[model samples]
Target chain A: MTGSAVSATALIWVDGERASALPLPDRGLDFGDGLFETLLLRAGVPQFQHLHLDRLAAGLQRLAFPDCLDRVRNCLQQAAGELQDYPWSALRLTVTRGSAPRGYAAPADARPRVVITAAPLHQDRCQPGAPVALDWAQLHWSSQPLLAGIKHLNRLEQVLVANQLADLPADELVVLDAQGHVCSVSAGNLFMLERGQLLTPALETCGIAGTRRRLVLEQLAPAISIPVAETHISPAQLTAADEVFVCNSIRGLQPVTSLGPRQWHDHSVCRALHEEYVGAMSC
Target chain B: MTGSAVSATALIWVDGERASALPLPDRGLDFGDGLFETLLLRAGVPQFQHLHLDRLAAGLQRLAFPDCLDRVRNCLQQAAGELQDYPWSALRLTVTRGSAPRGYAAPADARPRVVITAAPLHQDRCQPGAPVALDWAQLHWSSQPLLAGIKHLNRLEQVLVANQLADLPADELVVLDAQGHVCSVSAGNLFMLERGQLLTPALETCGIAGTRRRLVLEQLAPAISIPVAETHISPAQLTAADEVFVCNSIRGLQPVTSLGPRQWHDHSVCRALHEEYVGAMSC
Candidate 1:
């Protein structure tokens, strides 16, 4: 599903204070010099909270950001507590290298800023196992191992993909790396069921290592007694798979019903994975 | 030179009004969904104003941004008229796809926002033709043809380069593309002089097309009877070159005095180009 419009009912906090504006000099706005995490909030509780924070922490370390994990965690926790009224909502946490002089070199005593926004998601859009049509995006992700899987804010690539998606007939687009290897969906992780084994693309050189993707690979698949592997999957292999699905924190798992002319009617593997993952998320 | 501190004397404006805060949901902060131009303000006049605006306009078209060039031009002219007191300054003009819903897709009717900030520069730092030592950056630029040469806001790669520069003894770092082809210095375009010919890495795969670089390539070099070519350059070729220099709007040109152990004592070509380019910019 496309991103829901952030309604007036949305809650926003900048550095733990109730605010709706950021300094113009913020590195986040200046250079996209930051990291962000979007997690699902259920009944005021953030789903996969630790996983999101862990990813943010990893990204901070990768970007050589100052230690601001504790502050970010506090901000998320505080915002989630206030977002309990909405049964299903999306909580986006943004951590920037604060405001520095006009330069790429971050100040030695940089003070990081955290922005937390919680927006309500329609209940119907939050349901899992909905089948979606996919189109291959003409734009390919560039390989930068240093920034891969970090979910940092250099997302113009995805923005351009969204620009392409506006004119496409499909519900989502599958993006590949510069080498034309399958990478991910426009906004989620991709999985394929082949010969009773589930396969996902290894995000070594590109794509975000999504939190829900981790839940399925590390826990759900093992619990369901399905063999899973993270490997390179070519477009031909993807189209030839028995079942295909996309997953993210907000939209747990969506079965892919069609890709160009190829269609998969049987989504047994995707449904099973979604049910198990949802069951795990509630715990 | 490293970016100067945006001092208290700096002037700021947002959307044609004096302000220092941006809406929280601005796409620039969210997805870096925007383009920026950093121009040199000499004696209240922006050097290469049209060149910077032309590049920004091209980038806006590439990014599918809403048509806002006229507004941007108006903002720049208004700001330049107010900065007559600062003999030397840097004017950064940023155009973002305004505030939008939390998503990658740009709204059909995006209201673009412009942020203009003028920061005074130390007269000493504004001088051209200073020689700088260069070190090889361990981090390489990922090749994304779609985003190449556009000075968009997604600059985490350059931030990472600056991180590498902090601990290095060199004044600047020479970055390579993913394929190990010489791309640019940390914050400017790279040029190598060899056998009386000027060679610069083609920005088709990566690197920014700086306005000053354009001046040197299209005007200054030709004016001084030097042949220039935009082609792939290897690290070996760069080191073996007779002379090396880097250029950007803020810093007209800088001669490369040393790269590792290799040192260049003769900077006749670089000096000549710098003088001609400066003369052109002033006129």
Candidate 2:
């Protein structure tokens, strides 16, 4: 399921072309009307390709594009073949409803477009589980039941969070919903420790269900336990936590060095689990 | 400030004819990474081109596109030239971080793309200030501040709202926020008249800051006044009001003839304005 290349950079393809143009009418670019996954590859093999594909499938399903599975797999394989010699890289898979009649009423038969693009890997940004200094952003995430958990195309919130923290001390940020519950970091799933139990938001109300977060819970060592991260994220509970970390498929587990004004010693639980399950990299 | 071709259905330029393809890497489709405006064209001119363009500029600024105003205007002109002589159609102008790399680290020098497309006139969906029927959708709007009211590409919320009302009515839809405030209809701004004073939600917090809303407040009848239509939207307000109407650039003014479990008579105020400012529709 991984690409065929094995270099330090990723090879990209858009509908099987190394580089091509999207018509102005594409829904992906026009409406953020698509879904995507960022997966890491080492030695030409993608880590968790099936899981990433699964998450992408779930998103496609939510958006009503279940037929993209074949195109997605084939595109990734072709891109991997091109990058067969790269040492490290990442794969991005995107699917969107192609040109519609300038409105959201997508007909049942509208053909969707697929975009798979890869770029050179960076030593930073995606080095796996670095301790990212983070803080609570002033911006409150809106409660969107329809779009709470799924990683659909709409991502202004992520872009905004990234901007708010661009000049702040936080390399990343944790956003709260209107009721003051921890949703997740700017671009990752949040996990915290209270009395040594792994905890994360349920993601049903909001926040993305990071494929890696599921892995940490179900596949990581010390037995797959329920997330100590509860669905009802209260500020008081987070403040009283013993440890915190963020998770995503591409970046793995990033230990939270700081949150708001509180700082914590690196949790051994996170380190060990990340090392075992996520292939955590050293900062 | 509007394009020279005020009468076209939409701006059409074939591939490479005028920056035809939105360079294969537009973030709009990439992230639903853009905002758009569909304005009403009457008598071969945009009713509020300057205001619409200003909103587009503000949205681009919000999105961190570092383009000069002149650059945006030039793109508008190009699109306008192709739109000449097509009367009474909706004109769509979309601005996106044109072509960029695969990820969210927006390029430092991202050259934004401008797409102006027009579709054939369809008056069936929008017909004057006649009281349009609406049903209260079960779906509550997403409360993400980062995505709130910017009119950015993320519209899954709206899509969900649209889908929920398929069994009911489509002349309009009354959507509640997660907190249960009457947000707006499917595609237009809502105004409830209380004691003849116009009331609308403060879109600064969420919802599109409507150009038609602006014109109604700033240009239309000077007798009308605006009250805070803030986030604490209550259904009681809709019932307590004497008149309710929806407004958008394309739809002009559509009065709410009925709501779920309730109905209202047409207001004289809405009809007067339609006759005076809105005029007769050509399509």
Error of 1 at A138 (Å): 0.6
Compose the digit string of candidate 1's lDDT tens values, residues B110-226. Answer: 999999887887764345656799999998999999999999999999999998899989989999999999999989999999898999999998899999888888899999999
What shift in Å separates residue A16 of candidate 2 from its native position after superposition? 3.3
List DockQ, one per candidate, in order.
0.82, 0.53
Which residue runs does candidate 2 get wrong by more than 4 Å?
A: A1-12, A122-128, A223-233, A278-283, B1-20, B122-131, B145-147, B223-233, B279-283
Which parts of model 1 have CA positions greater than 4 angstroms off? A1-10, A124-126, B1-10, B124-126
Clashing pairs in 1: A44-A84
Candidate achieving the largest DockQ: 1
Query: How many clashing pairs in candidate 2?
Result: 43
lDDT of each: 0.87, 0.68
| Model 1 score (lDDT) | 0.87
Q: Give the Å error, residue A173, model 2.
A: 1.5
lDDT of 1 by residue, A196-255 (tens): 999999999999999988988998899889999999999999999999999888878999
